[model samples]
Target: MFEISDTQKIGVGLAGFGIFFLFLGMLLLFDKSLLALGNILFISGLACVIGLERTFRFFFQRHKVKASISFFGGIIIVLTGWPLVGMLFEMYGFVLLFSGFFPVAINFLRRVPVLGTFLNLPGISGVLDKLSGDSDRTRV
Candidate 1:
């Protein structure tokens, strides 16, 4: 029943992680002591950010208040947390890695069992179907 073009990709939030990894890689390239450790954090953070962005976009596109708040929240959080979060990735590797997976994990959950389909319903399908059906109804 699922169609290819009709299927949506889970949008990734790579920006946050990209920023985190970019900073971390810069930190690591500058300070080689953490080459191994930094690599892990970089990969994980990248996943988190890309995944986060996609998820946010998906839900954000749907609701009004939620979208507005999330849009503002992302800007505020990124602006405020940019330095702090970047540093966190640098100073605390594990925290950054965990941060990345947690969201992907949540999104992954929506792909499984009953709960997944229920929450991820495209929401617009039903409306479009109704409107397109028998446009002849409008014939005067």
Candidate 2:
């Protein structure tokens, strides 16, 4: 009894292809730069593979601001791959992308020693709240 939805099948295929290209680019490609392009493909494909409900939870829940930035960063990375900026974007995007899903880490990260200082900096929380659509309070 193996019945899978069309979307799930598509997701599995995209994820598989992404992983294959990633390995191929890293292990077989003549040019090392194809690795970055492969990474971009991998991230975008993974994004597409994730379901809307989980994606929404990741992007709009505890780490909405971080998730949004990472998703957009992934786009920018893909666009700028040829220009060499995509590599940097991909690295940063991956970090935030994963962080967006692990709710426990969000608060933990905010409480780290040096990192906490930066996280607590003025105006950041307000902007984050606004991005998350939390309208409990008014800002002047």
lDDT of each: 0.42, 0.57
Q: Considering every candidate listed, which one attains the maximal TM-score?
A: 2
lDDT of 1 by residue, 1-140 (tens): 85422122211233344445546644654333233334444334444545556645643554344434543343333335353344444344333324445555645665578876664455633333243342232211
Q: Which numbered prediction scores highest in lDDT against the true structure?
A: 2
Q: Which portions of model 1 show Cα errors greater than 4 Å? A: 1-59, 64-68, 80-140
For candidate 1, the C-alpha RMSD (Å) to the true structure equals 15.4
Q: Write the per-residue lDDT of candidate 2 for residues 1-140, one digit (tens) a residue.
A: 97767777676776677667656754663234555556555555555667766756666666457646765665465455542344445556556666444445545666689986775565875554444444363443
RMSD of 2: 10.8
